[model samples]
Target: MDRTLLEGLFRHAVAQAQPALAIERHLPAPPKGRTVVIGAGKASAQMAQAFEKAWPGEISGLVVTRYGYRAECERIDIVEAAHPVPDAAGEVAAQRLLELVSGLSEDDLVVALISGGGSSLLPAPAQGLTLADEQAINRALLASGAPIGVMNLIRNQFSTIKGGRLAAAAAPARVATLVVSDVPGDDPALVASGPTLPLRGGRAEARRLAALYRLDLPEAAQRLLASEDNLPPEETDAVFANNSVATIASAALSLEAAAEMARGAGLEAAILSDSIEGEARDVAQVHAALAREIATRNRPFPKPVVLLSGGETTVTLRGTGRGGRNGEFLLSLAIALDGVDGVSALAGDTDGIDGSEDNAGAFVDGTTARRMREAGIDPQAALANNDAYGAFEAIGELFKTGPTGTNVNDFRAIVIR
Candidate 1:
């Protein structure tokens, strides 16, 4: 298998999902009156820049993005904040965004650029809850191995600006949200905890998820969830009447671009699914088995074929690993393959960061396991300790692409020959 070709396919997939390219056509026209843009996400700053370039009239607003993911924009003020966890900077940004669009008329328009990571980038705790309280719950949720959908549900319950509350705040104005979907199935309500989309379930579901995950919520958070004082408003409320959402970019588009690249390289490509979900290591094991079958018996597809898939995966974190889900997936795949010939794979987050790690993901070939063993590193032991990053770093197989300025979710490709 050509490792260079496999890496090229992954790069092409990420390029296809770039916010600058995907957000242009979906931009709404300038409103008749004032146009105020407010958003929160890793891609939001880039999305704001793209909107400014495509927009004709003068527009002004503020958006919060993960620290180090900011894009240069003249009109829109880009604020950097913590991601995967909320901090004081995010709380301030969320408050300022709410104030920016507080009392707009029907002639005004609110273009909210929401994408992945917004839930953490724009943290506005509910009336009774504090930022530290929200932070505690968020930290627990990240370690709980719950899917993005359920995590966002819990987030919305404790946020003042999430679950359509941002749009509701700008009640009389028309709210047009341009979303870069990072969740499975491209559910707008799940992206960035759906600041402009309505809540799915009420506080009861939030409580159920917390109990199911055994999250030890803070006193204030527990009180907020238990009481009806700060629950999200009904979805059918009049505030949502003029709110609309458009998914400009998603994982499916990136997967298709990858398939086209594979075909161009004289290899057959199959996109298994763009909405795959589950534990990272378990998913990698399944892909490894499929690759083995194709390389040996050819049941699924012939040799010289690339299998591609997208979607986010979770890690339960039972150990003190220093890697994200992508690295964990590649490490597990290497172990399952066990030096089988003619198989190579790459797994990464399109946003150029995996979990809390600095690398986008990692790469592995058939000899990955053998190389680790030769270096006196036990692959199984590493996997057991959730130290995929350490294993990959020792073998010099980490893939680092700093801040791709967009996010659809995880990207995985297995090349069998």
Candidate 2:
């Protein structure tokens, strides 16, 4: 398989994972009373648009998504906000979303469109805790390379509308959550930090995670977590019992679609796993080794094979680098491959944003090293500084698909021919 063909196949898979189409298939019927839609995520806008198209009744309300990810809907309002960190815009949007569902009756319908990036995009800080406090802690969490679950656990405790609080606010309304799974295991509670389900962990766990990661959290956040009043949602048929959550799409399904495309192109395709998680660079090194062994000996599946995997990867910030997990993975893989022949790979986040960087991820071919050298970029220095974006930009090969309007996690494909 050539580099062009591999890129085409990867792009095809990404299109199939878009939220608008996926959300359409999972939408339920319109509620008996007013149908109010409220959600947060990178794909929230697209999800709302799909719901509006599918529903038969009057739909109104708002949802928040990452900047540049907004979609058009005549009845539903779309709000854009910052991601990976909470912003004032997100705080106001979150409060409005919660307010929309405040007086919903048992007959009312509250559709929560959940997806990746929602945790940061929807910020309703609890009483006595300012958005600045939440933002500070959020910044610390992102820099610490803590797992998404751990980070969200802390955020949920300090928020007025996360970890089942959204449902709690909706009182007697019948709530249904339509989520695009991005985290490993596709845990509904972890998806969008479980705005409708009962939260399990508490401040003790948050403090333990902070200690384990050595993160410097805000004093207000620390005290809030330590407070006895900080507790998870309680079980009740009215709120917890009536709320229904369903995963509309996930990384595993997306990987399967990609595998099918590869097979159609006459390449033997294998999906390694969908729940992969770890440091981005470390995972890339391991994947590179596997590809090398397979290419050299054909032990796994022989030549003309495409090894595919999907899942979110984390990066522990050790330098002032500007790249997402996909970029970091490609940098590490390039080093591991070390000019090896007959291997071409692409790693990228499905959401079209890698970390806070502009590009989703980078691609590497057999001659990627030579291309970097030709471009006069120091590949080793770039990797050390976490400057995958710079290195790939110099080579004119950075993957630039802006605002895919979806979030499943990372997509990686290694082709050996």
Candidate 3:
């Protein structure tokens, strides 16, 4: 298998989902009054730039993005903040964005650019909860191995800007949200905790998720979620009737691009699913099983075939080791393959960062496990300690693509030849 081709496929997937390419066509026409753009996410800055380039007249607003992911924009202000975890910078940005949209008229337009990582980029803690409290809960949820949807639900419950409150603030004004979906199912409400969309399952559902994940919330956060006083006000149907959303990019679309790239390389390609989710190691074991079957028996497709999948997978930290779901999945898959010939795979996050690490993910071939063992590294021990980053780095298999500026979650491609 050609590692270059495999890496190229991943790049193609990300390029296909970039905000500059995806956002232009989906942009709505200018409203009768001022157009105020507000957004948050990994792609928010680039999305803002795209909007500015295509708009006929001047537009002013603010957008927050993950630190180091900011793109240049003239009219729209782009602010940098932390991601996958909230920070003080994000908190400040979120507060200012709410003020920007407040007191708008019916003719005004609120163009919201929402995407993956927005939940963290826009952290407006609810009353009685401080930034520290929200950060504590966020860290717990990330370590709890909960799905993105469940985690976002808990985030929305504690946020004043999320759970449709942003849209509510723009009550009389029309809200047009342009989204780049990074979650499975592409549910608008789940993307960036749906700042401009209605909450799917309210506080009750959020409480249920916390209980299910066994997350211990801070005292203030606990009381806030339990209280109904801070709940979002119910808006008339007309308010929502004026709002609209357009999904410019998504995991499914990126997966299809990868499939097309595979076919172009003269290999048969199969997309298992775009919404596969669960524990990283578990999902990897399943993919390994299918790859083994195809390699040994050609049961699913002939040799020279690639299997692809995308979605967010969770990692439950137990061993206090360097971790990222993509790296963990690749390491686990390599272990499961156990030196099976003619098999190579790549797993990466489209946003070009995995967990808190610098590397996007990693690559592994049939010899990966053997090489690790020969290098005096025990793959099993490393995996047991949740140190996939260490294991892959030892064998020079780590993949690093700095700040892709777009995210649609994890991308996995297994090539069997």
lDDT tens digits by residue: candidate 2, 305-355: 999998777878877868888998998888788678889898888888888
The TM-score, computed over Cα atoms with residue i paired to residue i, of candidate 1 is 0.98
Superior candidate under TM-score, 1 versus 2? 1
Candidate 1 residue runs with Cα over 4 Å from true position: none
Q: After superposition, how far is residue 362 of candidate 1 from its true place, in Å?
A: 0.5
**Candidate 1, residues 208-261: lDDT per residue as tens digits?**
988998888898888888887767778889988867889999999999999998
Q: lDDT of each model, Cα atoms only?
A: 0.90, 0.83, 0.90
> RMSD for each model, in Å, please?
1.1, 1.6, 1.2
TM-scores of the models, in the order given: 0.98, 0.96, 0.98
Clashing pairs in 3: none
By summed lDDT, which 10 consecutive residues of candidate 1 come out lowest?
Answer: 22-31
In angstroms, the error of model 3 at 277 is 0.7
